[model samples]
Each structure stands twice: as structure tokens, then as C-alpha cells.
Target: MVLNKKGIIFSLLAIGLAGLFVLLFATGYQQRLDDQNDVIRARITSLDQGVDSFYDYAAEAQTIAGTAALDALYQEINQSGTFLTSDNFESNFTRCLNSSDGCENDLNLSVLLTNYSAIIATSLHADVQFSVNDVCLTQETFWDLVVRTNISISLTDTYAAWDTSRDITTTISTVGTYDPAYVAISASYGGAEDRRVFPTSIAPNSSRWNISTFMDFYKGRQYQASQNGSCLSDRYEGSWTSSFQGCNLESVVDADEHPRLKDPANQSITHMDWQVLTRDMHACHDPVTNPDDFRVSISDADDSLVLWNKDTIRYGLYPDHLDFSSPTYNAPGCP
Candidate 1:
């Protein structure tokens, strides 16, 4: 009986040790599962933050790209100051064509586009595209170019040119001072009888005596080149000098009129016009006619002179000089 009791005590001790091991394993497994769940939750939170960042980045990237486009537009405007003026435009265009190696002052398409694109790429891996209305500033279009960014937002404009023309024919108030020989030569060539003779009012020839001044009528020694009315003008700021009608061109442009986004809330937007005009100063002259057009006409009922569309038209000759009867014709005859 003493041996049996000792054996039972040993068996019970073994059972208790096995139960402690089972309890420890159950608690450890549960703790491991809890730790794994916490790790998963932290990962999920991190993923959500990443997604928010991506959205913000895309939106901010769009804003940056748009701003860059505006900067480019402003650059175009600043660089092309008064380039549309007749004097600057014609001369520069001619120079470009006459160049053998091509024009150095020609428009640089790559520079304009690449500069804009590089700025965006360096800041963010975004796409950008640029195109100009006219590659050479041909004065063909109102919009210099269109810039598209993020494949959605775009900016551009439309332009139209209007020219004013009117009749500018008038009788001369005075024949202006002329050399006696020149007067004699003019009278002999029927210049005095020319109703189309421009008065001493036009530019460069403002002090001229008659239309025969430009006529190659031999003044006995020198050959005269037909003097067309001309005005000296500088590009980028002003128009042609006018002693008669104003030689100005007007331009009007219209865009979608999109407001600039001043803040993120789409509020406090500012608007600006796309139109720019050649607002030149009025020319100095006597008895200022109309500033509306560069054309004019003058008449004395007997004869009429029309300076229309850059041409002089005469319907009749000076009074009594009809059929061209010189008061006193005395010349060595045609050479």
C-alpha cells in the first residue's frame, strides 16, 4: 500500500507539468495573433497616407504646369515688342530671307517648347506640349501659341486685324518754294496742269512743290525718281509719321476669358484682356484732317484729285490747262 501511494503522487506531478505547458502555448499563440493584427493595421494606415500624397501631387503638378504656360506667354509678349509694326516687320522679314545661312533672329521653336517642358520634368515627372499659332511671328494669328499640360488644361486666344482707308484728295493751298528752273521744267512737262499733283502736305515730300517732283522729268541735269509719299517709323512702340491722315492699324483679340486662379478654393479670380493695339501718337500737320484713315481726297469742282488706296486719281486737268495748253511753252524739246 505504501508503494502504490508514492506512484500515484509521481503520476499527478507529471500531469500538472503537462497542463502548464499547454497553458503557456495557448497564451503565446494568442499574443502572436494580436501582434500580427497590429502590424496589419499600421500597414493599412501607411497605405492610406500614400494615396493622399499621390492625389495632392497630381493636383499640385497641374497648377505648376499651368503657371509655367503663363510664364511662357508673357515671355513671348515681352520679346515681340512692336514687332508687328510695318517698318520693323518688313525689314526683319527681308533680312531673314536674304541671309544665306538662315536667319539668326528667327523663332526658336525648340527653345520655347523645351524650356517649358524641362521645367516641368525637372520638378515632376509630368508631360507638357507647346505649339505656336505662327512659327515665325508672321502676324498671321492673334494667339502666339497654345500650351497643354496634364492633357487637360489649355490656354490660347483669337485675334483679328482691321485697316482703315478713306479718300485723301485735296487742292494745294500753296505750291511751296521751288527752284526757278524746276518750276520751268515742271510747267514744260505739264506738271502744273496735273490735277493729280499732291499738295505740300504729304510726308518727306511735305515741302514738295508738285507731283512732278518725283517724276523723272529731267531738270536739265539730274533724273528724278518718282517720289511716293513715305513716312519714317520705328518698330515696337510707334507707327508711321503722318502729316495728313493717320496711318494706324487696329487689332482686337478675344479668348475664353478664363479667370486666373488666385487661390485653391477657386475664389478671388482676376480677369485680363488679350487685346493689344498699336496706340501711336497723332502726327503733326496743318489743318488736321481725320485720324480715321490714311486716305484723303480734295476737289475744287472743276478738277478732282483722289488719294485713295495709295493711288492718285484725277478726273480733269487744272482750269484752262484743259487739253494741256501751256501758257508759255519754251523748252529744248524732248531729249
Candidate 2:
């Protein structure tokens, strides 16, 4: 009888322990579910924010592009003999051709394009200057008058976006992880691990060649742009004629003492035929920049949106940057 009583007690204890295990497991699973739900919520929030922001982004970009006060201001500036000018723009581009063919005209298209979907972030400034009357330009005229322009973004902004993309992904990845790391960027997602990089520079013709890695960080918000066949090409035999009277460069003197830069002053040529597209863009931010460097009337825009002045537009196009600090989830089993 004593043996039977002891066995009964042992059975009770076993049943209680089993109940406790189930309770504890239930609680832990609920917590994990909550964590997973939180991540889903964050993803939803980010997407919703992007969706809601589309209108504002479009409006803001449009205001800068057309029919807004900024456009009016540009028009006013353009009219007041305050012509926006880009001059002496040399093609600081290197050949990215794989063919052993010569670099000349190897670029089938003058390309200055973002590889992914992009919206104008922060502030944008567009300036245009064309001649007042149709003018004939000979080799002498192109040398004399000059035609040039630039389309560029600041290095600070570019690098900031690069770094921030990784940071944000890292911050969002701490859930359900042993040691949290950043989200992985894949090649299809524009990951850049296969190429080479020069961490110290992004200069024109700086040979900042890295394999696919340079573009790995390109998250559609960032940029990789190239411009070619501008001002000098096979079409005009290297001479450019202008639709306006005389180019703005007519008033400017060469800061350099190169004899080839000297003006020929041969004004007798007529019927201009050749053309050039001065679309020079380099990404660099000087060490020192302030509110004035991005000069625009910042009335009621997002604080993050900035407008950079000419002086603030620095030259590095690709800075050597790689971070393994945040773990990369380049391949998530999740769709």
C-alpha cells in the first residue's frame, strides 16, 4: 500500500511538470510571434511611408521642374540676363568598354542615367543658357566660345545615402537574430561585390574601378551616372554650332595658359551643324559645406532635403566604402 501511494505522488509530479513545460513553451512562442509581427509591421510602415510620400516627392520634384515658384524664379533669373552657365566642361570620362576596340565613340550612347528607380531627393537646381541668336561655330568658334555644363550630386549626399541604407537595414534586423547584422544586398538587388574599389577617390577619370561592388550599394535612391559624346564627338568633326547668337563663354577667358585654349576669333563661318551634350556629373562633397553651399530658398521643405551651391559640389564619384559591421541578409527565404 505504501508503494502504491508513492507511485501516485510521482505520477502527479510528472503531470505537473509536463503542464509547466507546455505553459512555458506557449509563452515563448507567443513572444516570438510578437517579434515577428513587429518586423512585419515595420516593413509595412516603411512601404506605407514610401507610398504616402510619392505625392510629396512628385510635387516637390515637379515644383522644381516646372510651373512652380522655383520654376518662375528660374525663368525670372533666366530673363534678367542672369543666364545660368556651364562652361569649359571637358569630358572627364573614361572608357568602360569591354571590347579591345579604341575608346573613341566606343560609347554607343551618351549615358547619364541612374541604374535604378530614382526620385529627386532633397533639393534640385537646374540652370540653362543658350545663345540669343543662331550662330555659326567652326573649330575656331568652339575653341573661341566654348560649350559646357554639368549634372552632378554632392559626395556627402551620395555617401550618406550609401551608409544610411546599410544602417537602416541593420537597425531593422535585430529581431530573431543571434547577433544582428544588416540586410544583405544581392547582385539582382544591385550588390557590388565582384568589382574593385578605390576608397580614397571619386574624381573625374580617377579610374575608380571596382567590380559590381560599386553599384551594390545602389538602392535606387543612390546614383551611378555617366555622360558621353558631349561637345566633342564624331558628328561635328569636333566643331559645335549654337542656335543662339554667341555662347556665354565668349566673355570668359581661359584660367589656364594652354595655347590650344586660346580663341581663334574666326567669325566668318555660317550654317552650324555639329552638336555636343555637356552632361558632366561627378559625385564629391568637399570637407567644408554649410547652408549657403546648397543655396535655395528653404521655406517649408523637409529638413533632409538640401540644395548645394557650386562650391559645395566636390569631385569624388566613388569613395571606397565597405561595411561588414552589419550582417547582410542578401538572401532571405522570405519573398
Q: Pick the candidate with the highest TM-score.
A: 1
- Encode model 1's per-residue lDDT on 179-245: one tens digit a residue: 1211211232333211111132223213332334322221212211111211111112123222222
TM-score for each model: 0.27, 0.23
* lDDT at residue 305 of model 2 (Cα atoms): 13
Predicted structure with the largest lDDT when compared to the true one: 1
Root-mean-square deviation of Cα positions for candidate 1 versus the true structure, in angstroms:
24.5
Worst lDDT window (10 residues) for model 1? 268-277
lDDT of each: 0.28, 0.24
C-alpha root-mean-square deviation, candidate 2? 28.4
> Candidate 2, residues 42-107: lDDT per residue as tens digits?
654544444334333322332222112212222222233222223311221111111112222222
TM-score, candidate number 2: 0.23
